[model samples]
Target: MSMAKDKELVLSHISLEVRKLIKMYAAVNECTQVEMLERIVLEWNAQQSRTERPPGDEDE
Candidate 1:
């Protein structure tokens, strides 16, 4: 496994309700909670890339 995959990131100070929601989503989707979060982040990044590109910023 890569070092990045082995390292942990903490979502500190999040509410109990939010944590429960993540757990429930992971359970229903048959993925680990971290996987669910990673999927969400990946989707968010994709969407941001689509709408966030500058119109005249292409490189030659």
Candidate 2:
């Protein structure tokens, strides 16, 4: 297939995977998909921010 077709296929697969993940998390956590996604994004952002800091920067 052409490069455009390949990109579309990859995006489609990613979309499906995201939907499945949302459904699974919502069912397991007893929360709406949006709530679960919000929590996940917040945690991810916190982790990323922490990683960007220097080693001795964390307070006890």
Query: Best-fitting candidate, measured by TM-score?
Result: 2
Encode model 1's per-residue lDDT on 1-60: one tens digit a residue: 122353244333446787688779899999877776666668888888878889987557
Off by over 4 Å in 1: 1-8, 55-60
Residues 1-60, candidate 2, lDDT per residue (tens digit)?
123335445435547779689769889999866566667767888899989999889878
RMSD of each: 4.4, 8.8
The lDDT per prediction is 0.68, 0.69
Which 10 consecutive residues of model 2 have the lowest summed lDDT? 1-10
Candidate 1 clashing pairs, residues 3+ apart or interchain: none
The regions of model 2 sitting more than 4 angstroms off are: 1-14
Judging by lDDT against the true structure, name the best candidate.
2
Q: What is the TM-score of each candidate against the true structure?
A: 0.63, 0.70
